[model samples]
Target: MMRVKPSAFVMLAYLIFLLLPIYWLLMMSLKTNTEITSTFTLWPADLTFRNYQTILTDPSWYMGYVNSLIYVGLNTLISITVALPAAYAFSRYRFMGDKHLFFWLLTNRMAPPAVFALPFFQFYSAFGLIDTHIAVALAHCLFNVPLAVWILEGFMRGVPKEIDETAYIDGYSWPRFFVKIFMPLIASGIGVAAFFCFMFSWVELLLARTLTTTDAKPIAAIMTRTVSASGMDWGVLAAAGILTIIPGALVIYFVRNYIAKGFALGRV
Candidate 1:
């Protein structure tokens, strides 16, 4: 028999417990609502893919995915672009209230999303950005940019000041040195930061649902309207949940090597 420690078994059990709900959701997606409600089993009594079929064929359903991707992509790009310079500044310089300013930035991320929802909605409405993908992207940036900066700053601090000084001594312009020499050094931090940005924007429902009606409705919002006179469509709801997890999984797969290094410092 293979040897195993008591702690190993405990960890294995915890892993199974955590994964059981995901496995059950997959099982439920392959079942009909009637089969789902009538019995309880580890596997579906009648396995069918009609729930996935329904979502794939419906424009409203698939468009939810598209709209979500658009805004999430936009938000990630916007956050990283803005945060890179800010993170570099905080990492390299000692200026007035720098530490306090950094803490204040995190406070934006710390605030409850619901607290700002009404104000964001009103602000976007006045700018003619309501019910658009950009509106949702901008709203998410309120929180994403701060988090990106904080994480990136940690990674940047791990870099030595000598690199910046040497680049300047070589007569490289500031922008060129930052782009050519500096960014490549902190690539892992950027990957981790982008991963977080994508996840937060992808899973966020409060601001996304509140800001858009039809034109920019996200998959998270679309999942809510499956209720009917008969009742909620459990099969479809489970299917939607399964699909929503795929993008995040893919992101992690690509960034698996860098994630640990990305969060190594700055109290991450």
Candidate 2:
């Protein structure tokens, strides 16, 4: 027989405590709403996937997922595109008020999303871009860009300034050096930044909900609107929750190595 250490037992218990809610949601998703409400069990007495079927088949439900993916994709692309050059500048040069300017950018990230929701809504509405995926995506840039710049700046600073000087001496243009040389040097930073951007845009409820109406309502918003006269649909809600986790899981899976490097290197 093998013996377990006290530390191992403690870690195991903590892991179980953290995972219990997720396990419960998965179990509930597999059970009928009637069975869920009527009984308490570690596992479902009778399992059914009707909740998933209903969500998949319903336009109102499934579109929420589509809408979320649209904006999240846009946000990631925009954040990376803008942050690259900005991070390069911050890393390579110092000017009057450069540090203060960088600090101001990060302060935008620290403020609550609620503070900007109305301003974003009004601005997007003014441009007739409300209820569109790009609207939410652009609004997210205000927050994600700042953090993306911050993260990328740390990685860029780790890179030697000699690389830029050598690339220029070799007759490489600014755009070519940046695209072909500089980007690869800090790819882990880009990957980590994109991962955060995708997750934030994916799960964010307030801005995604407030900036759009029916057409671009994200899955997070759809999850909250599950209430009906018959009472909240717990089974479908649980199924939706499970499905929502899948994208985050996929993002982490693809970026796992880069994220590990990011932590090891240490960034803001």
Candidate 3:
């Protein structure tokens, strides 16, 4: 018999810790309200699709999904567009105040969302962008861009400078080089960065809830509305929560290969 490595055991333990909450959520989503509240059952006593049906049939719930998808998509696009150039510059150039600028960019990620919530609301209201998809997208960008830059910068650093020099020597313009040659090399990095951006913006509630009202509010905001004067609809909420994970799960699965490669390159 082969002995198990300590590192493998540690990783297995950590994986379980990370997935425990998600496991609970999935189990709850599958259970009936009576089964959930009457007693603690390790598994669902009665498995039903009623909760999922409620979400799909309700306009309010479906709209929240639409709103969340639009805003997160916009946020990811904007983050990647800006971060690509900034990351390339940071990785390739050594200019005045470069390190300071890099740290300054990262500082945005460190800022508490609560602190900026009010200001964001007021600013968007003044611009007549309140309760709109763009407002949420832009608000998310404050953090997403910084994160994208940081992640992409690490991946960009791993890429050999010789490639850029070689492209230039071959008479390739900067834009052509980046689009055709360099972009493909760091494709895995871009995938990872975009995945993180989408995941964070999708799950974040405070800013998304504050920035949008009824019409364009995200699923996260809709989840908050589950608690009301009548009572908390745990079943609907659980179902909505489960549905919310689908898009992210599909995205991660599609990019799983790239994600593994990107992290293996020491860019995580």
Candidate 4:
């Protein structure tokens, strides 16, 4: 048998550090309450499906998943749609305050979600948009839009200027050239931006919780309700946490290839 190198051992150690908590969460989700409390077993003494069942069957809990999907989907769509034009403008044109404006856009992402929660709540309530999916979706755009702009700008900047000049020389209209040529060239950037937007909005708790109530509450908010007068239902919370990772995990799995390609565009 061949011995492993020091670099290989270091990589294995890092992988363990990253995956150990996830493994523990999965184990906790499988265990019964008694097993969780009484024994610190590496594996569950009795594996049960009840925790998953509880989450899947309950309307409030399961509906939170649906609500999160809806808002996250909408947030991604809005962020990409808005960012595309802004990113193109920033990459292609020089306008008044363009540099300052680009930096200003990123400032929104730096604002603590907690600081804006109250103002968001009030602003939405004033418009009678509170506790709605659209409210959360729109609020999330504050951060997602800036991130999308930054990512897409890098990708757009990589496209050769000759491509635009050639499109004009060939008599292609701006809209036609953008849709038919420019978009395809940056598909990987769009994929990366969409993934980030979806992931951030899906996992966001503070604004999502503040902007929604019964009808539009997210799973993260629902998980907070697990603490009751009796006790914390660690199993249910674990199950909910596990389920929350599903959408993000799926998004990343599909776009994993694009991540490297997208970043490559930035380097160019």
Task: Give the alpha-carbon lDDT of every model.
Answer: 0.92, 0.88, 0.89, 0.90
RMSD of each: 1.4, 1.7, 2.4, 1.5
TM-score each candidate. 0.96, 0.95, 0.89, 0.96
Candidate 2 local distance difference test against the native: 0.88
Q: Model 4, stretches more than 4 Å misplaced?
A: 260-265
Q: How accurate is candidate 4 locally (lDDT)?
A: 0.90
Cα deviation of 22 in candidate 3 (Å)? 2.9
Whose lDDT is greatest here? 1
| Residue 161 Cα positional deviation in candidate 4, in Å, after optimal superposition | 1.0
The TM-score of candidate 3 is 0.89
Clashing pairs in 2: none
Which stretch of 10 consecutive residues in model 4 shows the poorest summed lDDT? 259-268
